[model samples]
Target: MNTIGSWQNHAISLGLPPNTPVKKQIDEFIRRWDNFR
Candidate 1:
């Protein structure tokens, strides 16, 4: 079965621009999520 990778998956689907401020926030979140490990 296929599964979504992460928020970045949805972000990619939505065609969010990499330079957008909101995308920057999500990028920060992904960074924090990794640091939690």
Candidate 2:
């Protein structure tokens, strides 16, 4: 349900580097956020 723009914003907010691929960023972001819960 995430749009590209919002996905990128979430990735950035998660402190993930922009140089990586979006798929990777999303996966990592999910992992990190899950751990935080």
Candidate 3:
């Protein structure tokens, strides 16, 4: 998804790998947010 790509871009900008824990946590939060809607 475009939104996910943008989030990953944030990781790239931070000089971290694509699969960082911070990204994982953000993805989980997004999943919960979509469910909450």
Tell me each candidate's TM-score. 0.44, 0.49, 0.46
Can you write out model 3's per-residue Cα lDDT over 1-37, one digit (the tens) per residue?
Answer: 2465665665565455765677575776677679999
Residue 9 alpha-carbon offset, candidate 2, angstroms: 8.8
What are the runs in model 2 whose C-alpha is more than 4 Å off? 1-18
> Whose TM-score is greatest here?
2
What TM-score, to 2 decimals, does candidate 1 have? 0.44
> Could you arrange the candidates by lDDT from highest to lowest?
2, 3, 1
| Native-to-model Cα distance after best TM-score fit, residue 34 in candidate 2, in Å | 0.7
**CA lDDT of every candidate:** 0.58, 0.70, 0.63
Q: For residues 1-37, what per-residue lDDT tens digits would candidate 2 score against the true structure?
A: 3455665566666676656677898688679789999
RMSD per candidate (Å) reads 7.1, 3.3, 6.2
- Give candidate 3 regions above 4 Å deviation: 1-20
lDDT of 2 at 4: 54
